[model samples]
Target: MAVVVGFIPTPVGFAALEAAQREAERRGGPLIIVNVVRDGMQGDPRHADQGQLERAQDMVRRASVRIAVRQEHTDDDISDVLLQVVEEEKAELLVLGIRRERDMASHLLGVTVQKLLTSSPSDVLVV
Candidate 1:
């Protein structure tokens, strides 16, 4: 099973990516990075640009495990997209990143994280 990580273009997201890479390496499994772009949110800061994705790919390539980066565009809930990926990939673990803001706990309790926490078949890790 792969290690699946939800990736956004943020510091927290990169941290999650790194952690997921380590987990994948430890498990001798592939790493799948899922970057979901909400419909009409292509310009959103959270959506990663091609350069950023390339950089992320380069970072992951430095490790020994295989890597796949998927940039999915959808109108559905982000959590749904991630859960679908988890099921499709038969992921052993799902990792997410949360911003370190004043209301960090609120971000942790957000709909996407909460949904995955309750609904995902694989283990969930938030970094």
Candidate 2:
């Protein structure tokens, strides 16, 4: 139905958006970006400021492709939110921004990344 992307304002996040947009265009579907902030998170640069969000919207506008951006702060885990959006939109693909893992203990390859990879119902693209 659409390409759902987990978005922040980070470099990997931007990369995910770009790749998802291209994939959506190729699939003839719209792009849906889910920008999220974990509840009570403070000063996390990942959460875009109003200016940054507006800029992202402007960029999407210039790209001239059908897109929907949803920003929210949730008490639930980020991975859960992403998976929920995928089902809500009936997304065929899920794009995510990922950073390399540092250790092999319980921490795992970024907890949320691992969670989403294992749990999402749609095809996942880690950018």
Candidate 3:
């Protein structure tokens, strides 16, 4: 199965991509880059815009790794979208970047990452 690396527009996300690239290189497997964008008012009306998909493809191209980039527009929360992508791809691995915070413990106490970790059915590599 392909390795699906979920990308977000964050420093941690980029770092996770780097980690995924390294792992892909070592394993000699194809990588699929996915960016889950929420579309709507509470999220962003332009989340489904073609420009966003182009940008995601550009980012994947710039990564210089053989990858198939996909932009998923959904009304669901970002974390939920990510898990959905994982299930859809039946991915061999999932890579994510952990954002830097003033207090790591406090940040982990929040919802996003913790929720994903708790709900994920596959191996997750947090960078």
Candidate 4:
């Protein structure tokens, strides 16, 4: 089975990528990095640019594990797209990055993370 990770351009997203790579190496499986760009949202910070995608790919390559990067533009819900990839890849684990408010005592999960946590067919890890 593969290890799937949701990647954006943020630090948290890179963290998730690193975690997923380690997991993939541990499991001796391939890594699938899914970067989703919401359709008609060119200005969205959540979407990764070409440079960012290349950087992520390079990072994974240096890890010496098999990698497949899927950068897609979609109008569907982010969680749904990620779940679909996980299903298609037959992923054993799904990794995601979540933002945390420094002022809050507890970190609140994002909409996508919440949805995936409950709906994903595989196990999930949030960084």
Candidate 5:
């Protein structure tokens, strides 16, 4: 079974990675860490591409995580790509990090975690 972890643009992303790593380790399943590059950067494509991806890779490396890491570009909302990956990869579990916010309006409006939890057919684990 594949464990899919969604990497967002916050510390929560790393937290999610850590939690997923632990769960994957326990379950003895392959883990795939994916960071969705959202559209809208007014700089060199190479720089924009490498900036976030490299950091994410470094985090995995530093964590000594034994998992496959993939970086993907998406023009659509983050939730869209996340759900697509879940289906395409046949992920049995989805893990994400959600920052606690007092403003429920923001999350209810359209947060990635919320959308993933509601839309995913498989089990979702939010750290």
Candidate 6:
């Protein structure tokens, strides 16, 4: 089984990749980097651009783990895409970047995070 990481072009995304690298190393497994966007979506600030994806690939290559990077455009929710990655990749763990929010609405947790925490069979690591 591989280690799966949700990736974007932000610092938090980098942190999640780093953490995933360590986990993959420890497990002696491949790394699956996943970036998902809604079908036909454009210019979403949360998604990574081509250049950023290339940089992320370089980083993964340098990490020396067997790697697969998937930029998937899906109609499904991001959480479902992530969970699908976990199942399809047979991932041992799922890693994601998270930023703390003080807003009361956010205290309930984001929909994606909540769905994964409740539905995922694999362990999750939030970095």
Best by TM-score: 1
Q: All predictions: root-mean-square deviation over Cα?
A: 1.1, 2.6, 3.3, 1.9, 3.8, 2.0
Better of 1 and 3 by TM-score: 1
Distance from true position, residue 114, model 3, in Å?
1.3
Q: Give the local distance difference test score of model 6.
A: 0.85
lDDT tens digits by residue: candidate 4, 1-127: 6899999889889999999999999988699999999998879998888899999999888765689998977998988999999999899999987765452223334566678989999999878
Summed over model 3, clashes come to 0
List model 6 lDDT by residue over 1-127, tens digit each.
5899989888889989989998998898799999988776778866888899889888878766798889988877998989998999889999988764445357337788889878887999877
Angstrom error of the Cα, residue 84, model 5: value is 1.3
Kindly list the per-residue Cα lDDT of model 1 for residues 10-94, writing each as its tens digit.
8889999999999999988799999999997657887998999998898888878889999998998999999999999999999
Compared to the true structure, candidate 3 yields what TM-score?
0.74
Clashes of each: 0, 0, 0, 0, 0, 0
Question: What's model 4's overall lDDT?
Answer: 0.87
> After superposing candidate 2, which stretches have Cα over 4 Å from the reference?
100-108
lDDT of each: 0.91, 0.81, 0.69, 0.87, 0.72, 0.85
Poorly placed runs, candidate 5 (over 4 Å): 41-55, 58-66, 101-111
In candidate 5, what are the lDDT values of residues 1-127, reduced to their tens digit? 7788887646777788778877766666577888777667435232225566566667666443367777777767778887888898788889987667646556555666578879997799977
Stretches of candidate 4 off by over 4 Å are 102-109
Please give the ranking of all candidate structures by TM-score, highest first, separated by commas. 1, 4, 6, 2, 5, 3
Which ten-residue region of model 2 has the weakest summed lDDT?
99-108
Q: What is the TM-score of each candidate against the true structure?
A: 0.95, 0.87, 0.74, 0.91, 0.75, 0.90
Error of 6 at 38 (Å): 1.4
| Model 6 residue 98 distance off true place after TM-score fit, in angstroms | 0.6
Q: For model 5, where is the 10-residue window of minimal lDDT?
A: 41-50
